[model samples]
Target chain A: MDKTQQSHLLIEDLSVARGERILLGGISLRLSSGQIAEVTGPNGVGKSTLLRAIAGFFPVRSGRMSWVESEAADSAPLAERLHYIGHLDGLKSALTARENLEIGLRFLGRDRRTPLQALDRMELAHVLDLPVGYLSAGQRRRVALARLLIVDRPLWLLDEPLTALDRHACALLKAIVAGHLGSGGLTLAATHEPLGLPGTIQVRLGTR
Target chain B: MTRILLVIFVRDLMLARRIGGGGILGLVFFLSLVTVVPFAIGPDLRLLSRIGPAILWIAALLASLLGLDRLFQADQEDGSLDQMFLSPAPLELIVLVKCMAHWFVTGLPLVMLSPLFGLMLDLDGPALRSVAATLLVGTPTFTLLGAIGAALTVTLRRGGLLLSILVVPLAVPVLIFGVSAAQSATISFLTPFLVLCALGLASIALAPIAAAAALRTAGE
Candidate 1:
């Protein structure tokens, strides 16, 4: 795409490493608004690392990851524009599902009502008052996904979001991603299995 | 906001209660140490009284260090620490909130229960008051300094012992002033109290940055 047509996320010749170990080297990709980029790779091919780098959670050892909000070309701070979810679901186990959602909302500085509605949409109302430690793995995963529903950021970076989730939860998450894309929000998700998301653009790493 | 701090403070206290024994174990250890000193000295009440303030301060210092290992370990293991780091609020704010919560659960309680230890150590009324006041100012410094050590060791396999080693030396200045203030309160309180408050304020300004840097190092 031409520069004018690329007012979105661009990862150009990016390289990252941890000490002497190179996590990813000379990788590049671009993601436009309203598009979902599904990153597929082997287990240790630095998929989560890539997502984290894009979200500014980790530094790019070399090269650049740029975000253009509008006409401006320089990249903004990654945290300012993206919502990132790593392998470890970030939920307070001692807190009830509702309280966990509330904390997530406060973190995003979004409305609590929206998070409550998200919990309802996920069909988690029955256990909203139960501490997350009491919930099953699938339920915990759903609570994490509920964060995606309530947060209003334009970009989502999720790693292995479907892990441990049941068919219903998986389908629910896919639908949420689809809705997010339809609303001009972008997504960069890394996963081992194909998510069966319709019209997603796939970026295969490790092999190429 | 104070409300946010209060919520975090209460939550941590509840967790400390449910976990049971870690927070109180330190106080119990402090009590025993204070009581055992008289036995070791062979009925020297004069010496005990003279050294009582310092003894109480040292005991409080060690007791505060008791649960330092768990400051960020549980949160890191559970992924809540990562969430806090990523929250829209600045990471420094999160560090402050977490440290304040920790102080409430561990340090504040020790300060509250310190008078009994003072009495056992034959600390006079003025000395006991000094011990309490110094702890009120000093333990927060202890908590803040311990945060850096906790953050640095949070990801290590052998974290607890290493954290204590790293932090106790850094906390030496605070302990010095803490005990000094308590010991001198019988005759001259103002100078030591001012010095202790200065140490606390300096720590309040610097420790958060150090802790944040340590956390970033651990993350890398």
Candidate 2:
């Protein structure tokens, strides 16, 4: 296996709150390259909130997170090195699948693969020209998933990535996650279902 | 940075075009405001001409707000706004790009059609030219400042009304200077026009920062 130098992410005693309720508290984790952390719990367990905190979507009420590239502490903006897919799918209703993928890659400043190639990898080649709003829920999820492939970011924060996926699409997702891990990348997924990837670390969250 | 900005700008323009309502809605609102003023004031051509600049500025201001709610609302609903937060480009730059795109789609057409609307209100050559020119320079400031309000109200369900309330007060100076520039076209148009430009330049520099901060807080 051709392995690049690993990146390290450390979170210490993280806490998140919404209004008067504490969603998560005293959470800590360390992830390096080629690692996958699966956040599993029932609904309203802060699985999504934890992922959002790591992706910098929500404020961390306490504690800190540090990302180190190779041997040095990387102070570059987290967004530059991470790709985040949330529950909304992020597809513009008027745009085609290909256009969404292309614009998404450009917006992220990643140009590794063409939109067509990325959609092809997601088995969306046949519907490349159709508007995303016209796509089914499963198909739209595939298009969003295709963004992870088009952009070559090291850290992927996926919130319920498999929610709308069918059996075949779920298999494709597993393959993609595995392939991403094989190439010294990090994935933090918040899902209720089993990710079923080898050597994955499971972090279960519950109401505080 | 330029490439990313261009990509966002182009994508927004495309969305505005395909979505098929924002620009047209603003233009139609502008047209109705122009046409209705004659009826409301009983077809007094001189009176219409006298208040033409104010009417046009008022109409333009209201029309600009017609689609302001959609500025960030659609992106927030569809989750592209969150994706935008993750872009390497600073959120301020993204806000700037979105504002520019909004101006291009909504403001530009209103400016282009203002002269015709001015003619309807019996504005002569100098008056019409001044109105168009003022709109060309002033509407960008309107859109930029309005972007902040839009960002602030993006998370709300009926944000359109609140957006107008928030934006209209901030727009008072632009309205005053814009109408003044048109009224003084026969005198020293340069002075008020220059002031309008200054306000525009200031808004261009400041609104994006404020709007980006509002968006971040709203996300939180």
Candidate 3:
């Protein structure tokens, strides 16, 4: 894997809409390597929308979102450089956890670890063979978290990453985010609870 | 790119097989449709042989639409569609690969079983081979067309009926050529069969692009 190089996302006056009704507007933020942007807002405020728009899931109404890398000017499309964990886990419950992660790893490219090792990292090595449907919500969340470890990407877009986690799983996630940030990776998460990590930049939606 | 497409293909295939009902549902639907037909048409052997290919083609076409509404709906609801859009592979190719895998799971079986159903229709050996061959080439077109419908309606609560409606009209050309080619076992089969092939090839090349665009429109 290439050594962690400097990368940053620059968003200016980013406004996103759903159909006619505008969900959020006039949002400006800059996230650089090693910084976490925790988007907070009232329910229905579109914290998820901003992160998703940044992930290239929706068309921005009006704004300039640019990516700057120290290594190259025109880097790969933003999709390949990021990992998006949305409101729903992008997993096939019919497949085992190992199969799920392996499919993600194979599809996402840049395999950093085997599926077993990633699950082991998430304390889910034992449930690797179980169908994801049988796992509890917390276990399923961790299995989804294992996705981050298997594929190496610089940007992590997490939506409600802490929903079903026990205190222990939260700690695991915190440590994982710390490691990712330490390696100069950036995270933009939409969550109600604070990530409990130092120096996390907060962006609130549905305000102003 | 190939790796990503291959995994998607394999994953979809595995899901289709493990889900246990898609293939069987399509087969059972095709069988029931055929079984119910002779009751209406009566057991006139000559009449049945003449119209056997059309009956089989219509049944297969409807059955191909059976499991298609779930094609993108499952992925959409599970959030896999968003992740898929985020993949480096082009969405059009991914859509194509998905439809191809879906056909492998659902459409091919109907083709494989057409001969037995043809026998029930009292079709001769040449007609049996023609039905199977035409269906083998023709079913993928149905799936490709249905995929476009599936992607367009991925977000609706109950899109199955709408999916069939949207797909069947567009599928008329495929149905026409497929039935014609299958019925031409005695006459020069090459003409209609070539048209069927062209229609299939054209849909294969174009349906994915339209489906991918629809998914993008309905995605967010």
Prediction-by-prediction clash tally: 0, 0, 0
Query: Model 3 Cα displacement at A61 (Å)?
Result: 1.2
Question: Which residue runs does candidate 2 get wrong by more than 4 Å?
Answer: A71-75
How high is each candidate's TM-score?
0.92, 0.97, 0.97
C-alpha positional error of residue B130 in candidate 3 after TM-score superposition, expressed in Å:
1.5
Stretches of candidate 3 exceeding 4 Å from the true structure: A1-4
Better of 1 and 2 by lDDT: 2
lDDT of 1 by residue, A1-208 (tens): 1223334788899988889878888888888877888889777788888887776666678997777777466354667567777877877777788877776766666453565688887878788889898999988888888887776777888888889888887888888888777777788889877777777889888753
**Candidates by TM-score, descending order:** 3, 2, 1
Q: Taking the tens digit of each residue's C-alpha lDDT, what string does model 3 give over B78-109?
A: 88888898788999999999998989989988
In candidate 3, residue A169 scores what lDDT?
88
Task: Calculate each model's fnat, 2 decimals.
Answer: 0.35, 0.78, 0.71
Task: Rank candidates, DockQ, best first.
Answer: 2, 3, 1
What does candidate 3's lDDT look like per residue over A99-121, in tens digits?
99999898888899999999999
TM-score of 2: 0.97
* Whole-model alpha-carbon lDDT for candidate 1: 0.79
Candidate 1 TM-score to native = 0.92
